[model samples]
Target: MINNAPEVLRYAAFTTDPAGGNPAGVVLDATGLDAAAQLAIAAGLGYSETAFLTPGPTERSFAVRYFSPLAEVPFCGHATVATAVALADRIGPGELLFQTGAGPVPVSVTAGPDALEATLTSVEPHVLPIPQADVAEALTLLGWAAADLDPSLPARIAYAGARHLVLAAATRERLADLAYDFDGLARFMTDRDLTTLQLVWRESVGVFHVRNPFPVGGVVEDPATGAAAAAFGAYLRTLGETTPDAVLTLHQGHDLGRPGRLRVELRAGDARVRVTGAAVAIPADVA
Candidate 1:
């Protein structure tokens, strides 16, 4: 129903600097828009995904939906951060609730000396083993040999609102080369109900380099992936690789020239994960 640009707010999640994180589009109010309209806008913007928020005055939360150019996603982390930061700018920094298709997500925003930072606590996360056959197929599509994989970090299907296949690379070089079979991987992901392939390479125990192949979303890669970070936190816990109160840092988008950082926090006695980052506006005229 919005005939114009609808005041799209741009933000780069996970990094304080505008140049160092994943950029997302946030439409704070899209209550009247339909699926087709949402898709059209996302496609037009062409930013991996866009988040639409519908306010519910009576309720403590707002209805939220995520749309990629290709389809609707149950949840999207970077977009959520972007939306939260956008809302904070208007409504003042505070706690906000989002009712997504996956579940209710609570976000908190705080004002920093330089900029505002937002933290989102994910829904309960879980991890599942990836089938060997599927892993082989995915590896083939990505042109990655078995030796390129990291044995320490096993392949898994992790879920925190959405599902992503976590494939850890043996080296940073292997993770940087992202040329893959777009249509083939897309088909493979669709068949398995996967949102993306969370390609990664661990730099250290707490630091990692990552890339997300989102062919299903009609995007080549996601700069900073909040959902995948949450899932990866669960994946690490399931592997018994990290302590209960561990914090992981994910660096992404450097390969694509839009480098961003995502901070993931895991707490004891809580199945949910927390992802924190900062966002900034991308001028409508520029992008």
Candidate 2:
């Protein structure tokens, strides 16, 4: 075992129940922990991602870094939400700024009916058209055909704090069946610096069922993805799919047996997207 490991707290983001959301390891005080140590802890924990927090320049702010099992990531939404809730539980609900690799992220935490809800405002988000050849390759690796895609949403690469391939499914059934070539997809994503594939199926106006294939993170899938949700919101905005000011509901992780809900908000004139979700601490033994 590693010597003097930093205390790693466990929390589940985007769900009130411990077993109903994405779990993330949170190092509340990683002042002296180096990248190797953080990566070790994250790898040992085997969560999709872990968050390391160090004091920032000002009060109520922290310099946070995220690590997957294999490598460090610029940003991770679920881990951010987990860290924010963990901090709120100790410091009381309020606003906190996170200095992340992607950029400075502002988060607000408030007590919800059942759990603490944290809202993270993403950096200015943008979308880019993915090459047809790349999309075709991705479809082949995913065992999906061109007809499986939803022409309304179109395929694009979206960036909020991290890059994600946004692909909408023509039907909920297509989105539900998510057996993809892990190794092939991982290689594909690594070459393109993609964090996850935001596979979605629109349920109704401003409501969607989403799933994230996160092979690049060394995880097969992410139960609740905040970054991808933010990216998806931006994608919708760029496509003129929703009103300037709109609230979207995303249902994710249900197929994985860890159902979670994310609330995505877009404001008029603001290029940033806001994602809100509840998080709860996981008991040590349970975690």
Candidate 3:
């Protein structure tokens, strides 16, 4: 168990179709791989992120780590979802707890006739205001002007497991056409310890479209971002954009030709946001 992991599995989260969602590599039994080996494996897969799991006292619990293409992240929502569903496929769906660097995350998986779905409850979420200067600088990197931002949503840094700047576009067109200065944005994010910019546009009362620029992860863009979705839900709840108890739907990756959907739920008394979606394994041939 030193160098050789039991198996390396590839799965896509937030969508039932492997071709639609964000892809992640999962090692269900990574009992011996160290941080360097984990980083190498994640980089080799070339996905935005990958997860490694070490068994805990019981089969229902494990210590998990997430590695992006460049570095180790405290947590990753999509990867967590993928791992839970992958485990469910073998052990049958129920509950699984993952001890992550950020905190403990509890995931519930349910097996259905069509696919396996997983819902992950995030840690307590909070929001903080983004400095006007910082927001302006970010906008400049994105090639967007102040007028392009939706005045109603405002701007803030939201965090559930990771931090993301919540910026709302005035229109869907603005959100769809994403071409940013990658290096500049990367520098800005790294300085602020930001994971991705949650560039979003509200389509209606409960539906929204989003795009995430994950330069820090060494990816141009994330087709589907579950962590951002959870953060955005907390942002909305904080801003009174949505009711404290509401279900919101997010559509992502369509602009990249890989469409994925995520469901976000907020409870009245609970501060933790629940992000739910289905994950499917990418066939070996497709990989």
**The best candidate in terms of lDDT:** 2
Query: Worst 10-residue stretch by lDDT in candidate 2?
Result: 1-10
**Clash totals in order:** 3, 0, 0
Poorly placed runs, candidate 2 (over 4 Å): none
**1 or 2: which has the higher lDDT?**
2
Kindly list the per-residue Cα lDDT of model 1 for residues 1-287, writing each as its tens digit: 54754766777777676766777778887877888888888888888889988886644468899999889999999999888888888878999999999999999999865678889999999999878999999999999999999999989999999999999999999998889999999999999999999999989999999999999999988888999999999999989989999999988888988888788999999999999887877654543
lDDT of 2 by residue, 164-267 (tens): 99999999999999999999999999999999999999999989999999988899999999999999999999999999999999999999999999999999
Q: What is the TM-score of each predicted model, taking all chains together?
A: 0.96, 0.99, 0.97
**lDDT at residue 184 of model 2 (Cα atoms):** 100
Number of the top TM-score candidate: 2
Q: All candidates' lDDT scores?
A: 0.88, 0.96, 0.92
Q: Please list all clashing residue pairs in model 1, or write none if there are none.
A: 20-259, 20-260, 21-260
* Residue 131 lDDT (model 2): 96
lDDT of prediction 2: 0.96
